[model samples]
Target: MAEDRRKEIVRHLSEDDLDRLLAETDDDKISKRLTFVKRLYKGATLEDAADDVGRSSGTATRWARRWNEGGLGLLTPNFGGGRPPKLDEDEQDELIERLRDGQPWKSQEVQHLLSEKFDAEYHPHYLGTFLRDLGLSYAKPRPKRPHQPENPDEILEERVDDALDEDDQPHNKRAGDDGEGWVVDEDVCTDGGTVIGFFDASQPQPYDNSRRVWYVDDPHVERPLVKTEDSAVGFYAPNGESLVTFTEDETKERICEVLELIREQNPGKRILLVLDKHGSHIYEYTRKRAHQLGIDLIFLPSGSPHLNPIEKVWDYLKWTMCPIIVENEGEFKILVKDVFERITRRISYAQSWCEKFLDLQKLS
Candidate 1:
């Protein structure tokens, strides 16, 4: 037969044979043996295979010789057995202590430190495994905060009381109709000074949504002469051809003017006016005058602008006026007039936008 009558005995090696080979040979030597086996399977002579695979003919012949003698067991590796660690228990404890104290040390850092300090050349990965075997793990230290005073309970109690007091206060209450009625909305105008003036009306509704539940059937309807501005003092309403400005004014003239407008608009009907809790709006004179005009001035809760419908109207005006550019005061006024005209004409569209706003608030 042709030697062992097999063209490629390399293919017939079992898993156990391969394991033995790997166990018997180091990684570098096994690599050389694998190359030789490949060449031999490809029909190269033993001598040629040895030379081609960078092994001596004698080593190649020895591998072939072993194969014929005892099958594939000759290729396997054997790990020599050892009793125990050479280092004492105290030494291991010292090593662990040294490692723990010297950290901020990565495995590679520890390995480098070992080589530099103790003339030990350890692979980084092996060092990691060794540390893990010794029950050492990487961990981050907790950060410390500044020391606080011990009597924080008093301060906390005071804060809680203040919060509760604020919560207990009445918020945006709807104004009762006191014979002087007005609509709260924005008005756009072509005034000679600014392109647009925001006319905000402060009239009280029968019920406040901030304080109680109150809904309008036609909340989106554009009541005439309502003008809002993002830049102006407040919303405005038409005072004849000119616009009347509403602000948080304490003066009697402004308060009287507002009262007069409400009485004029609603006639004999009691007027409800919702107003902010500004010092000016809360003056005794303003309140007395409003009472005299049959107007009930309901004060809006502090710091809640969203409760006011006039604020929403102003927002709409700003949205509408964003695209219009005014070169001068005249152009600005014209643009404002045009915007108001468009808004007035497209009443349904304005209504839809307002409805959408309400819907979004609901969803939120």
Candidate 2:
């Protein structure tokens, strides 16, 4: 019965496909086993199937065992074809050295090299897989840099405490002084395009001053000219009614004017003037004037433009008075003057803005 089953399986095979399978000598036994298994599935007895396929009873039993265990797949042959690698240990080392020396051996380059040097035709993709199997990969070359000092973990807390202590100390300390002195704040406007207006937090009523207290008082208040290439019209306000243009010479004059006003107002009081670090404000003439008037001038650190209160006032003016257009210089002057009048009336708002700015600086 098994021999009959095996013959039936062989009869079902396509002649052309069977002939192709027979062409691979190594796969013949596996193909014969597949024919036996097919016959067994069709209900032939094991012994008859074995005889019909010219196999011994033991061979038929083995094929039956494989079919019962794994079905038709057990009778199929695996075809893994390719030549063994030609590049051995020494060749691998040479390839790595060439790559390390900055020679480009990309898959295409390697393929070209193989054809030229070893007379082997290789696909670029195949060569790439070969290189990958050898633990090689395409990567960017990185340059090395000098080592830096390592952070000392144990001293981190102590270093941080020292920094905090240094920051807490007063910036300027007098000899043998234990108490921290006060820091006065002052703002200097350097751009002079037009006279807008000014707000003095130090004065409750800046408009009530006999002399013009802001940019609005300047004779050239109406002309909307650019003070400097970097500035727009009315960029800096020096006095309550004066828009002083930004110039080394003009800055010196404004500083002198502020010093004069401080001197005139507080005849006996020693004043500390805090100003932005503009070159003209720190010039010899300005310094001498401050010294002569018994004014101590302290400047804000460089690049800290927002530290100056005048900048805040300028921002307010720009927001409230921008888009202010005039047909003539006189008309422009009148508009600017009106803006100052409005600012003078809004002293409370000015004070609120100034206080908020100072609070922000403290937090920063």
Candidate 3:
């Protein structure tokens, strides 16, 4: 009876059935089973067929036995037991649509939202894969401001004179035991400058930065919609000391106020301030006031924020604090101040900026 059943099974699958099975099945194991059975019906020995398809002879024999008992019905997947999906198809479709409503969502925020809305729980790493499967991707969000400077190269070239020698090595400075009386490149400051710092201002926005966000790319993408707060001027000193204050405007008055703060902090000390050429910075009154306060304002060439090591501090601050998502100006100021304090408390950060110039050998 078993011999007759095996013969019947062999006759049941035609060449067309074999081709269709191989073409339609995507599962690797199922495709291997079909190939094994088809080869057996094509005058191949059980061992030969198993060897051709890289299957064990025992696996081939077991599958053949099942086929003889139930024909093709036994070959179909059983489709049983595993963890169910956290979201149904409809819910998944809705979640994708909700994400499209605008603004990128952080991975943690999205994970929390999933738990609240659909009672779904996922490991943070797995959540990234799940998001990609749903046709979402990670992207960096940048601020879209008008008339960004295009002369960073020129600015860098200008500063290179102050940093490099004729042979392009660092222009080193000699210092006393107290690390004072060092001259960098020349004309950097008087014989004994008190403090060295980078000065700049930035207007942070409500928009997020320095974090991965879930976003769908459209061919015709526009800048992200974001709200900005009032600007702040800052002076970052070599010892990681920073003077940051909120300003309603970037006028000469505000510039003078910040300089006064710098003067108060370094009482009776000369400051070598590396800054850019904003109209307020170049204003006759601002320059005179800076000179009177014993602050030598060294202007950076056009469009050169990269030369300012303190710019890195601004980048770090935005990435660390902006993603927290403050609603009002009050919260924004408080959070920014707190984060700034935490960052500047480390003296190592200040030394790192100062080392860039100090490491160079003195120009002979």
Could you say which candidate leads in TM-score?
3
Show the lowest summed lDDT stretch of 10 residues, model 1: 188-197
TM-score, structure 3 vs. true: 0.43
**Model 3 residue 219 distance off true place after TM-score fit, in angstroms:** 20
Better candidate by TM-score, 2 or 3: 3
| Local distance difference test, each candidate | 0.46, 0.46, 0.66
lDDT of 1 by residue, 163-255 (tens): 223222222222553333232222311122211111234321112223322257654323233232322223232211212233344365675
Give the per-residue lDDT of model 2 (tens digit) for 263-291. Answer: 55444444444455467666766666665
What is the TM-score of candidate 1?
0.29
C-alpha lDDT (0 to 100) for residue 64 of candidate 2:
65
Q: How accurate is candidate 2 locally (lDDT)?
A: 0.46
Clashes of each: 33, 26, 5
Candidate 3's residue-wise lDDT over 1-364, tens digit each?
A: 1221222245568878888989997877678778878877877766677778775544455566667766677754453457667885457766776777754899888988788888888898799888875657799976533443566545544454354323322122212222333223232332343566788899766566445666677433255544545787878876425678888889998899998888777664456677888999877667766765656666676655667776777888887775576667787777777776676655334464344444334311
Candidate 3 wrongly placed segments (more than 4 Å): 1-193, 209-228, 347-353, 356-364
Instruction: Give candidate 2 regions above 4 Å deviation.
Output: 1-254, 261-270, 330-364
Worst 10 residues of 3 by lDDT: 168-177
